[model samples]
Target: MNNKTKSILYGTLASSILLGVYFTVLTLVSGWSFTQ
Candidate 1:
């Protein structure tokens, strides 16, 4: 892949991981339960 495409892919992947981590931490702190 070219530099531009590679960077975009890496950036998207990083953001996704960060967002997932953020939500996980938020739910953990709030004692969130998905079934509820």
Candidate 2:
């Protein structure tokens, strides 16, 4: 594999992971607010 391809793959993976964590935190916060 080339350097460019590897970097693209890594960037996509990191962004997806960050987005997942962001949404999870958002959902939990909303849920807690609803309970209170």
Candidate 3:
């Protein structure tokens, strides 16, 4: 793959993982309940 394509793919993957972890932490810290 080209540098531009690889960079874009990596950026997208990193952002998604970061956002997932951010939300998971936020929910745990806030004691969010999904079974309510």
Query: How far off is residue 2 in model 3, in Å?
Result: 0.5
lDDT of candidate 2 over 1-36, digit per residue (tens) = 999999999999999999999878877888766544
Clashing pairs in 2: none
Model 3, 15: alpha-carbon shift in Å? 0.1
Tens-place lDDT per residue, model 3, 1-36, is 999999999999999999999888888887677423
Clashes of each: 0, 0, 0
Best candidate (score: TM-score): 1
Error of 1 at 30 (Å): 0.6
Error of 2 at 28 (Å): 0.6
Candidate 3 local Cα displacement, residue 32, angstroms: 2.0
Worst 10 residues of 1 by lDDT: 27-36
lDDT tens readout by residue for model 1, 13-34: 9999999998888888877784
Q: How well does model 2 score by local distance difference test? A: 0.88
Error of 3 at 5 (Å): 0.1
Q: Could you tell me which residue pairs clash in candidate 3? A: none
Candidate 3 displacement at residue 10 in angstroms: 0.1
